[model samples]
Target chain A: MDKILKSLFDFQRFAGESALQSIITSVEERFPANEEKSPRTALTAEEMDQISAAGNAYLQMEKDKWENLVNGGN
Target chain B: MAVIDGEEVYLLYRDKVRGYISQHVNQREEVEDLCADVFEKVVSSLDTYDSTKASVSTWIFTITRNRVIDFYRRNREHAELPEELASTEMLDAGLLREETLRELAEALMKLSEEKRTIIILRYYNGLSLKDISDKTGISYGMVKVKHQQALKELKKIMKI
Candidate 1:
C-alpha cells in the first residue's frame, strides 16, 4: 500500500513539474516584450538614500518585534 | 543582538515566496503585489514573530496564505464556479493542464478559511507540522491530521 501511494505521489510530482514548466513557458512567451526592458533601474542619490533609510527602518522594526516576542514585554 | 536585515530577509525568502504564490495564484501581477504585501506584513509584524515557535519562512508564508485567502474571499462573489463540479467527468485532463491551477485557486477559495490556510502553510510554505501547530495554536496531532486532510482535498480538486 505504501509503495503504491509513493508511486502515485511520484507521478503526481512529475505531472506538477511538467505543468509548472508549461506555465512558465507560456508566461515567458506572453511577456517576451519584457525582455526589451532593462532589469536595472537607475536610482538617484536621494532615491538611494531613501531606500537605504527604509531598509534600516525595516530592520529596526524586525529587531524590536523579535525582542518583544522573546522578552515577553518585560 | 544582531538585527534581521530586510535585504537579507528578501534574499532568503523572495524566491520561495514567489514560487509558492505562483503555484497557487494565476495572476502574474497579483503575485508580485501579494509578495510585497507578505513582506510588508512580515516587517510590520516582526515584533510579534516568535522564532522558536515558527521559522521566519513559515511565519511569512502564513501571512502570504492569509493574504491570498483574503483576496479570494473579497472576490468570491464575482468568481465563476468551474464546470467540472457539475459534470460527471472525474477530472478534466486538458482543464487540469490548462485550468487546474485556476481551479485549485477556486477550490482553495471554497475551503473553510482555516483549512485553506493550513493547506498553504503546510504544502506551499513547507512548514513543519509542529510549527503549524504552534503558529496556529492547534494541537500538534490535529495539525498533522488536518494537513493530511487538506492535501487530500487539494489533490482531489487538482485531480492529482
Candidate 2:
C-alpha cells in the first residue's frame, strides 16, 4: 500500500515540476537569470530560535489534542 | 498523528515550511510569524489528512500557498515582492516576474493531481530525481520516463 501511494505522489510531483520549469524557461528566455543579482541573505539566529519555539509549541498543543482523540475517543 | 510523533513531525517539516514561507515573505520575523500560522493550520487540520490524497510535504505546501495568498490579501498595501527572487532592485528593474510563476501555477493546476505532485516534490520541495524514486520505490528508469512524458504534456499544454 505504501509503495503504491509513493508512486502515485512521485508521478504527480514530476508533472508539476515539468510544467513549472517550462513556464520559467520561457520567461528566462525572455529575461535570463544572469541579468538579475538578487541578494541571498541568511536568516538571523534569533529568528531561527523563534521559528523553532513556535513550531514546538504548536506541535505540543496539537499532539495533546490528537492523543485525546485517539485515547479518549478510542 | 501520534502524540509522541508530533514533535518529530514538526522538526521534520520545520525547515521546509520555513523555506516555503520565506519564498513569499520578506523579513525574517514575518517569515517566522507566517511559518507559525502555517504549522498551526497543519496541526489543526491533521485529522483530515488523507495520505492517499497527498504526501505530508505536498499537503503542507498547499497550506503555505493559501497562507501566502491570505498574507498578500491582508497586506496588499505592503507591496513586498515575492521571495522567489527577493530583490526589490530586480523587481523594480522588471527582472523577476510574478506573472511567470502565475502562468506555471496555472499549468500545474491543469495537470492531474498525481502529475502535479511530482512537480511540487521536485521543483517546489527541491527533491532530487533519485530521491523521488527512492521515496516512491519506483524504478529510476520509470521515474525518468514519467518525467519526460509529463514535460511533453506540459509543453503541449503551454503551447510551447
Candidate 3:
C-alpha cells in the first residue's frame, strides 16, 4: 500500500512539473522584447566600409556604436 | 557582417527593455542601471550571439528581463513574479491572463511555506516528487499531498 501510494504521488508530481514548464514557455513565447516599427537610421555604405576597415585593424563594433550614439547626441 | 555595437543595440532597445523591466519594479531609476547592465552583458556576449536564433532585440530584452528577476531575488523577499510576465503590450487575452498569472504568482506566495516550497520544487524546479521528497526530507506521500494542496490553492486564488 505504501509503495502504491508513493507511485501515484510521483506521477502527479511529474505531471504538475511538466504543466508548469509549459505555462512558463507559453508566457515567454507570448511576449517579445521590442515592438519598434522602424529600424535605426541606415548606416551609409561609406560609414559601413569605414567601420569595416577599422574592424580589420581594431575598432570593435561596440566602440563604433558608442561613438555614433555620442555623436548622434542621444 | 558588421558586429552590432552595444551602444547601437542599447539605443534601439532601451525603451523596450525599460518598459518590460518597469512592469516588475516600481522604481524608475533602477531601470536605467539595469538597462546598462543588460547592454554590458550584450557587449560581452556579442561574439556568441546568433541572429538566426532570435532577433537582436529579443535577445537583449531576454537579458534585461533576467537582470530584473535577479534584482528581485536579491532585494525582495516575497517576489514570485516571473520574467515571462513582463509584457506591457496587450494581447487579445492578455489583460486577464496577465492579471491571473500575477495573482497566481502571489497566490503561490500566500500558500503555507511548506506547501509553497513543495510546489516550487516540483513545478518551478521541475523536480520529481521522489526527488522533492528526498530533497526536502519529507515523505513521498506528504510531498504529493502538499503539492496537490498547493495547486488547489493556486487555482482558488486565481478564481477569486
Candidate 4:
C-alpha cells in the first residue's frame, strides 16, 4: 500500500524520461508552470559513458570474485 | 542464457538515474558514483528480476530512489527526508508499473484544483506541508489536512 503510494508520488521521476515528459505536459496543461523549475534534464552522453565504464569494471570484479571462490583460491 | 545485460541496461537508463539523483545530491562526482552503484545492483539482482511484474524502467527507478533515500539517511544533509521516500517499503513489483502512474495522473485530474496542486507540490516538487502553506498562503494546519485528504481520495480513486 505504502509502496504504491510512494510510486504514485514519485511518478514524475520514476516514470522514466520520455514518459515523464508526457506526464509533465499533461499536468502542466492544467496548471501552468510558474516559479517552479522544469524537471531536471537527463545526464549527458559523455557522463554516461564514464559511469558505464565504472559499472562494467565493478561487474568484472564481482565475476572474478565468484570464480575465485569456486576455484577455492587455487 | 544471461539473465540481463549490464551495459545495455546502463546505457538505457543512465540519464533517468542521474536526473533523479541530481534532484537530491548536487555533487557531480557523487552523482556518477551513485549511478554506477545502481547499475551494479541491477547486475547483481538480474536473476531476481521478474519482468512480468514490473517493467525494467520501473524496477531500476525503484532501486535509484532507494539509493538516494539511503544517501540522505547516511548523510542527514537534508535535515528531514520526505516521508513518502523515507519509509518506502520493499519494492512491490506488481504495483510499481508505469500504468499506476497514469492512473495516478487520471486520479489527480479528478481531484479539486486545490487538492491537485497540493498533491503535486508535496510529492512532485518534494515540498513539505509547511513549505506548501508558506508558498500558497494556506495555514499550516489546513495544508496538512488537505494533503492527507488528498491522499485518501487518491487511494479510493486508484483503488489502492
Reference-based lDDT, residue B20, model 4 = 78
How do the residues B1-160 of candidate 4 rate in per-residue lDDT, one tens digit apiece? 2366778888888888888788767889989999989988998998898877677888898889888887777778644675666545454656667777777778877888778778777666666788778777889998988888888998899887
In order, the B-chain TM-scores come to 0.47, 0.50, 0.48, 0.75
TM-score (0 to 1) for chain A, all models?
0.45, 0.44, 0.26, 0.45
lDDT tens digits by residue: candidate 2, B1-160:
3222456668887886777666557789988988899888888888777765555655666676567667876887977534332222122222112333445568667876545555555554445678667655667787777766666776676554
Error of 2 at B103 (Å): 18
The TM-scores, one per candidate, come to: 0.35, 0.39, 0.35, 0.63
User: Residue by residue across B58-111, what tens digits does model 1's lDDT show?
Assistant: 456556656766666566796432221112123222332223344555656555
For candidate 4, give the DockQ: 0.15
DockQ of each: 0.01, 0.03, 0.01, 0.15
Candidate 4 clashes between residue pairs 3 or more apart in a chain or in different chains: none
Error of 1 at B68 (Å): 0.9
Comparing to the true complex, what docking class would candidate 2 get?
incorrect
Q: Which of the predicted structures, 2 or 3, would earn the higher TM-score when compared with the native?
A: 2
The parts of candidate 1 lying over 4 Å away from their true place are A1-74, B1-3, B80-160
Q: Score each candidate by Cα lDDT.
A: 0.57, 0.58, 0.58, 0.75
Ranking by TM-score: 4, 2, 1, 3
After superposition, which runs of candidate 2 have C-alpha atoms over 4 Å from their true positions? A1-74, B1-4, B80-153, B156-160
Q: What is the lDDT of residue A10 in candidate 4?
A: 67
Residue-by-residue lDDT tens digits, candidate 1, A1-74: 11222222222222343443443344335333224545788889999999999999999999999999989966
Could you give the interface RMSD of candidate 2 in angstroms?
15.8
Ranking by lDDT: 4, 2, 3, 1
